[model samples]
Target: MIKVKRVYDAPESDDGVRILIDRLWPRGVKKDLVDIWMKDIAPSDELRKWFNHEPEKWEEFKHKYMEELRSNPKVKVLIEVIRRSENVTFLYATKSPYNNAVVLKEYIESLLTK
Candidate 1:
C-alpha cells in the first residue's frame, strides 16, 4: 500500500518505507527518520515556485508534476522500493494536504496499475 504523510508526523510501525520526497530537507527533521530521500522525484524548482501551494493551481500542478515524473529516471527507483516493501509512505513538509507527495502518490499508483 502507498501512503502520504507529513515529514513531521511520528513514525508508525506500518510506514514500511519512508521516502522523503521534497527537494529540500524539511526544517527540524532528522535525516535518520527517512529510509530514502528522493530529491529528484520532487517537482522542479520552477514548477514548485509557480504553484506556491495555491489551491486554484492544484490541477495544473498535478498535470505538470506528472509530466516531470514520466520523464524522471528516478521513478524506476521509487517503483522498485514500493515493489519490495509492504507499504511506502511519501513524506513531505507542506501543510497543504494537496501537496507534491499527494500528487506523487497518485502518479505512482497510476503507473503501477499499468
Candidate 2:
C-alpha cells in the first residue's frame, strides 16, 4: 500500500518507509523525521515554480509533472524501494492536499498496475 502524508504530521508505525519527496528540506523539520529523502524524485524547480499550488493550474501541473516522472531515472529507484516494502509513505511539506506527493502516488500506482 502507498500513503501520502504531510511532513508536519506525527509519525505512525504503519507509515512504513517514509520518504520525503520535496526538493527542499522543509523548515523546522528534522532530518530524522523520514527514513529516506528522495529530493530528486520531486518536481523540477521550473515546474514547481510554475504551478505555485494554484488550484486552477492543477491539471496542467499534473500533465507536466507526469512528463517529468516518465523521463526521470530516479523513478526506477523509488519503484525498487516500493517493490521491496510491504507499505510505503510519501512525505511532503505542502499544506494543500493536492500536492506533489498526491500526484506522485497516483503516478506510481499507474506504473505498478502496468
Candidate 3:
C-alpha cells in the first residue's frame, strides 16, 4: 500500500517505511523522525521552482514531475523498496496536499499495478 502525508504532521505508528520525497529538508523537522530521505526521487530544482505549488499549474507540474521520475534512477530504488515493504508512506513538506506526493503516489501505484 502507498500513502501520502505532510512532513509537518506528526508521525504515526502505522506509517510504515516513511520516505521523505523532498529535495530539501523540511524546516523544523528532526532527522530521526523520518525513516528515509529520497531526494533523487523528488522533482528537480528547476521544475519545483517553476511549479511553486500553484493549483493552476498542477497538471503541467504533474506531467513534468512524472517525466522526471521516469528518467531518475532513484525511482527504481524507490520501487524496489516499495516492493520489499508491506506499506509505504511518501512524505512531503509542501503546504499543498495536491502537490508532488499526490502525483508520485498515483504514479507509483500505476507501476505497481502493472
TM-score of each: 0.98, 0.98, 0.96
Give the worst 10-residue stretch by lDDT in candidate 2.
94-103
Local error of candidate 3 at 73, Å?
A: 0.6
Q: lDDT (0-100) at residue 14 of candidate 3?
A: 82
State each candidate's clash count.
0, 0, 0
The worst-scoring run of ten residues by lDDT in candidate 3 lies at 94-103
- CA lDDT of each candidate? 0.95, 0.95, 0.90
Q: Write the per-residue lDDT of candidate 1 for residues 55-92, one digit (tens) a residue.
A: 99999999999999999999999999999999999999
Off by over 4 Å in 1: none
Write one digit per residue (lDDT tens) for candidate 3, span 1-114.
888999889888788999999999999999988999998888889999999988899899999999888888888899999999988899999888668899999898998899
lDDT (C-alpha) at residue 56 in model 1: 98
TM-score of 3: 0.96
RMSDs, each prediction?
0.6, 0.6, 0.8
**Stretches of model 3 off by over 4 angstroms after superposition:** none
Candidate 1 least-lDDT 10 residues: 94-103
- Clashing residue pairs in candidate 1 are none
Runs of candidate 2 exceeding 4 Å displacement: none
